[model samples]
Target: MNFDASLWLIFILIGLATTLPRASFIVLGSRVALPLVLQRALRYAPAAALAAIVAPDVLVAGGQVEILNPKLAAAGVAVATASLWRNPWLPFIAGMGALHAVRYLSGS
Candidate 1:
């Protein structure tokens, strides 16, 4: 199959649109003092993004809501482990362990 230049330009434009904000922030640095309220709001960005990605997967499976699923349980354990241990790696291990344990028990 042949790729078209217009398609490449479209892809580049899409990528640039996504990247510009972050790149601009890094370049501008502290010169751009975001408002106090905005700064506070930004503090929740990571959790919000994490929830956006994870909430649906954990809450819905096979077109059914399964809030008590192992994957979600594992994620919670991972978050707790991370927070308590104050170590980055332990959370990953804990999450993986929890997920695998769930899957193993469920035979899925």
Candidate 2:
């Protein structure tokens, strides 16, 4: 492999971008206060991000819409199994098993 100056520059830019916001928070913490509305909205950021990441996978099938997917079904099963069995690992195993079972049965 060869080292490229452009690649290094790109990496440097990415690192700077990632660090600058965090550094800004530390450097300007006392000088600034997050707006109340913004803070409230920020509180939902994780949920929004999780939905953004999982919603598509759990809702989409083929090129069309499918509100009920194997993953979603498996999640339901996982939640139920977890609650009933009270085992953390069982949920994961059951979820995967349910998803695979659906896939196998559906032949998709």
Predicted model with the maximum TM-score: 1
- Relative to the true structure, candidate 2 reaches a TM of 0.62
lDDT string for model 2 (1-108, tens) is 997789989999999977996697698878888788988987897899887997777767796777667877887887799889977799999899999999888888
Instruction: Please give, for residues 1-108, the per-residue lDDT of candidate 1 as tens digits.
Output: 988789989999999978996797798887887789988997998899988998888778788988878878898898799779987789989899999999899888
Q: Clash pairs of candidate 1? A: none
Model 2 CA lDDT for position 83: 82
TM-score for all models, in order of appearance: 0.64, 0.62
